[model samples]
Target: MELLQLQYFLVVARLEHVTEAARSLHVTQSSLSKTIGRLEEDLGVPLFDRVGRKLRLNEYGNKFLHRAERALFELEQGKQELRDLSSPEQGTLELAVTAASALPHILREFRKKRPHVQFHVQMLATQEMVKLLHQGDVDVCLSSPAVEEEDIECQVVYNDPILVAVPKGHRLAERTSVSLTELKDESFIGVKRGYGTRDLADRICKSVGFEPKYVYEGDEPARLSALVEAEIGIAFIPSTARNSRDQIQYLQVENHELVREIALLWHKRRYISQTALEFREVVADYFKPLT
Candidate 1:
């Protein structure tokens, strides 16, 4: 019934381990167990199925988890709204980004305008970003293949064209454009599969009837350029991340509309702080020229 009880139960439901969850919650295991028991008693149903030291969310717990999350989300929004009212000029913006290439420019421009404002940036995969946004963990998300959840507001900020990057001496480097089918046999360097760009590239390649053979899969987009430059493999890269140095050549994707729609997403009903609004404006301004 108590807020603390709900909070504790949610944590236990997530971890599914009493000792681990209690350690993370910074409470004694017995105390955490007692709290969860009280919450289950209040609800008149057992939330979790117990097996020795481990716990698993039962059907009831799975159903209640969503409600608990929403309750906490609303409470957090209320707190943020009050904080924004008290300190309109200074606040931390929780930003999650899947489009890592564009983030530096956006943050730089935003910092120039609001030096007093701060940022907590998370480089997250598309699914993780969406999950956090729904949970109210992030204020906003810059994502690709925009999130389509009914409760989330997603607006396209930039239509970033995807291109193929190759080392200077590579045959594709001389071509101004190449089709996805042409790169079928080429060894590739790519970001990991979870990344927006990587997923998009895979889908586009699949559409053309082949999957790219990644010689090296990495986490950093910046490293893709380096890998291509070393002739380890060619890569599908966003136009915004095209390297200026002649060592790498960026070729347009011919016969396909290979573009990632970079989007800004936030919960439509969540309270938006003045600083967050300003930050959104900054993001819009930064991507305007690129679009």
Candidate 2:
């Protein structure tokens, strides 16, 4: 069978859940199921037995697991061993993130140190990152903290204290920060549903005992910033979004210690490559993101 087929087989075996495995792998469940079926046909034996909707590894499957794991381990070891010979800095790091602020310095330093290594970065939602780690589609992810799911292990990379972005002319800009009570009647630009930012925005508003006036909503970070510059409403973004903009200013909320913690996540069961670990160190040092 192909390497991909074996990898998929192992993922399915670990999860014993086709749907979750497929979602994590960033592939359709039907496709993965077919791949496993083809693999079983080639081997003339089934690795899984479906009991209603659940899957269990049969005796034959358990017997094959040791061999399969050995093979996978050897394959990875081969790649790791040959890393030095492949190129100057060798090996590839595939990482995905949800925003732009946390990228620049880390990327520059990574490329500078490992010019031969390659990078693949994707901006994704917090849940998407956790799913990909489970399926092995990506090795690492950074996003907002997800508490409800115990399946995904996450560590805080940076605690992003939520900052208020308002146009300079606004009355609130005179203060260091605003509070939920202070901004109860103030116009607000809302983050759209289904996005990771939306949850934080909603929670902050709810704490004030009032729904925010929705000036606008979208996936674009720039659009929301523009609305704030136009003074249509105030927007809340991570402190990192604070940049040199004359028309716009960032302020802290009064007595509001609300922090939108950005986290680095991975499947606790998986082993991270040395190269990936190096990258994590650089990122951790890059922002030195405030706690």
The number of the candidate with the highest lDDT is 1
- Note the residue pairs that clash in candidate 2: 177-252, 178-253, 178-254
Deviation (Å) of 50 in candidate 2: 12
Note the Cα lDDT for every prediction shown: 0.88, 0.75
Q: Please state the error at residue 183 of candidate 1 in Å.
A: 1.8
lDDT of 1 by residue, 1-291 (tens): 999998998899889999999999999999999999999999999999999879999999999999998898789889998898898778889998888787888888888888999889998888898898877788888888788989899989989999888899998778899888888899999989899889988998898899999889877788888888889999989987886877988889888988999889998888988877887898898888766
User: How many Å off is the CA of 37 in candidate 1?
Assistant: 5.2
Model 2, stretches more than 4 Å misplaced? Answer: 1-88, 146-153, 194-196, 289-291
- Model 2 superposed RMSD (Cα): 5.9
Task: Summarize candidate 2's per-residue lDDT along 46-120 as a digit string, tens digits.
Answer: 899997546789997898888998789778757655663565357778787765566776789988877877779
Clashing pairs in 1: none
Candidate 1 stretches greater than 4 Å from native? 13-17, 33-70
